[model samples]
Structure formats: C-alpha cells, structure tokens
Target: MTIISTEPQLMPFFSDAFLEKTARKCGFMERLRNIGPQSLVLSLIAALSKGNCTSIADLHRQFNGMCLSEKHTVAYKPFHNQLRKSAFADFMKTRVTFAMVQLIENVLPPLPKKFEQFDDILLQDGSSFNVHPDLAGFFPVASAH
Candidate 1:
C-alpha cells in the first residue's frame, strides 16, 4: 500500500533519533526493547491515518502488522501496557509540539503585523453539556444561588 511508501517521506519530519530522544525524555522509554519508541509512534500514526483502528486491540494488530519480522511482533498485553503508561500522553505531546514547531518554521509563512504580537491564536466551539445530577459530586458545576 501507499502507507509503506509515504513512511519514508514522514521520516524527514519525524526522525527516529528525535522520537527516541523525546521518548526517553518523557520517561516512555526505559530501555529499547522489541517495541521501540519509533515503531510505536509510527504504527500509531499509520493506524490513525487508516481510520479503521477504533480500539487498542486494533492498534495492537496494526503495530504487529507493520513489524518486519515475526520476532518483532509484540503480544497484545505488552502492547496495551506500553500505551497505558502516564508518560504516553507526554510523549505524544512532545512529538506533536515538535511537529508543529517544524511546520511553523519551515512550511507556514509569517503572520501579518497585527497578528504577529499574539503568541498563539485559539479557536474553540462554545459548546456546553449538562452533567447528570448523580455526577454532581464528581463534576461540580458553578451555580448562582
């Protein structure tokens, strides 16, 4: 598939060295094992891009499928455990931040004079939802008595 071909293009943006460094910095990598940080990150990106991977199990399958050999394939539990770590979020955040910085520096043009003063521009949908009464203790809401 084109997925295999496109991976080489992505390597320039998300290099193996950078992925390993960030993973180590974020405490996601203690020591390199069967499932390296690069493999995990690339597999995740590829799986998500396909849009068919709806669960962790699906992701696990995709990871194994991407492996070059049977020996490199990880078990479902180990794969799940790797992603369950608290540092997983930090690891992903670092990667995303790096990518965004790279895009801003190399790809995107400079902002106009008026907008240049702002560090970042944020847009949010002003959507709100009511929590169930039973969840009030867990999710407290502000009220005007």
Candidate 2:
C-alpha cells in the first residue's frame, strides 16, 4: 500500500489557488472568513492522514490547530454549521474527483492489452475467515468446521 504524506506532497494536489477556485465553484465559499477553503481542506487532509480523526468534533479541533494564525481559529458551532451545509458535500465530491483524476493521469499507468476490453478495473479482496457465532447469520461461513 502507498502512504501519502500530508505536508508538501499534498500541496501539489490541493494548492491554495485550486482550493479557492473550486470552493467558489462548488458554493462552499459564499464569503471570505476565518475558515477559508484552503485552510479547511489542508486541515482535513492533515487530520485524516494521521489516522486519528474519528468525528466532526475531532476535525473541528484539527482545523483550529492547523490554522494559519490565531485569528483564523473558528468556534465549533460555526465549524459544524459549515459542514452541515449541502455545499460541503459538493465541495468534498469535487475534490475527491479531482484527486482521482490526478492520480489516474499522473500516478497510474495505462491498462495492459489483456484488460483493453474493460473500461475500468476494480480489485477486491476475496479472502474470508470464520466469524463469531452471533455474526453467523449476517456473515455466513463458506463451510462448517
């Protein structure tokens, strides 16, 4: 598995200018404020990269901690309000699409001849193991022991 660092490496994919433009396009940035698109996106990326973020409250704290300055810190209510908006979903979808496109274009190689017939290839792990008796109805085993 490849691990992407959250610092200078992520900057290429989410530059300040790109974040600003996309936020405006997605209606995520209705007005300039302490929690700008760049800061929010960078904070989210950093927090997620660390693998400790479990909830929106965690993200809110991460955002304040990573802000450019003290003046940029935002209260949890305002931060949660921003996230509850529909624009937030659109913004995240747009960013994920952009990142996927960038990964395919720059990092991934072209498909081989054997797979030319397929437009896309999705890989899934098929390994399975026994589960607790309580979950047997939910996740049936391949064969009884």
Candidate 3:
C-alpha cells in the first residue's frame, strides 16, 4: 500500500508570518514557545483535511506526525481545552474565512465583461427557495399548500 503524508503543505495563503500576526492579535500567544498558535491551527486543519482525524487523540497523532522535532508535544486535553475557548473559536472562523476568500480571489479567473457589469455577484448552492407572499401573483407555487 502507498503511504500518504498528512503533513501540512505550507499553503501560500497561510504564511507563517500571517498566522503569527493573527495569533498574536487574537492573544492566543503568551509566553511559552514550544507549541505556537500557528502550528496548532495549521495542524488542526491538516489533520481534519488529510488524515480524517476525529477525536482529540487523533488530533495529537496527526500533529505529532507533522512535527519535525520530537522534543515537545502538546497533550490532547490542553489542546482541546484551548480550542474550546470562544476567543480561539472566533479567531479560527475569521481567519479560515479570510484564507478561503484570498485563495478564491487568487486562483479564480476574472469574470467576463457582461458579468462584470454588476457590482457584486453572489453564487449560492441549494434547493429552490419559496417566493414571498407579496410576489405570489407574479410567481405561483407549483404545489397546493
């Protein structure tokens, strides 16, 4: 069987300096240096995306595999507890969303001139939505309610 690597690929969008700046701004970094906030965030993303890591134990395993040095390791409970904090949760959500937007902006091709006429373009994916009662005259419902 071919071995698959779960190590972080060092994404261009998530640079070390960028993550560090975000972590510092969010107050995730204090005095200790071994397990930096950036490493924790990157490891979490890599584990969930690559190894299909589930429980805190699996998180530890995935993180350990990505580590270059074997000197220090973050325990599962501490890592879990840290992630549970509201501040960290908000920070991760904002940063991840920002990263995704940046990635799309960088990789996606520019829109055609016809589409570019609009100030904004929203692309949503879901089942058809019901029309408001105000527009019932214009658009009748397909099925009887």
**In TM-score terms, which candidate is top?**
1
- The digit string of per-residue lDDT tens for model 2 on 1-145 reads 2456334444556787888888889998878888888788888888898898899999999999887778878999999998898999999898988777655565668778899999878875655555678877777654353
Error of 2 at 127 (Å): 17
lDDT of each: 0.81, 0.80, 0.68
Per-model TM-score versus the true fold: 0.68, 0.66, 0.61
Candidate 1: 10-residue stretch with minimal lDDT = 136-145
* Candidate 1: tens digits of C-alpha lDDT, residues 29-119: 9899998988898899999999788999989999999999999999999999999999999999888876666445654677789997899
In candidate 2, stretches whose alpha carbon ends up further than 4 angstroms from where it belongs are 1-12, 111-145
The per-residue C-alpha lDDT of model 2 at residue 112 equals 82
Candidate 3's TM-score: 0.61
Using TM-score, rank the candidates from best to worst.
1, 2, 3
The CA lDDT at 17 in model 3 is: 76
Relative to the true structure, candidate 1 reaches a TM of 0.68
Name the runs in model 1 displaced over 4 angstroms. 1-12, 106-108, 112-145
Better of 2 and 3 by lDDT: 2
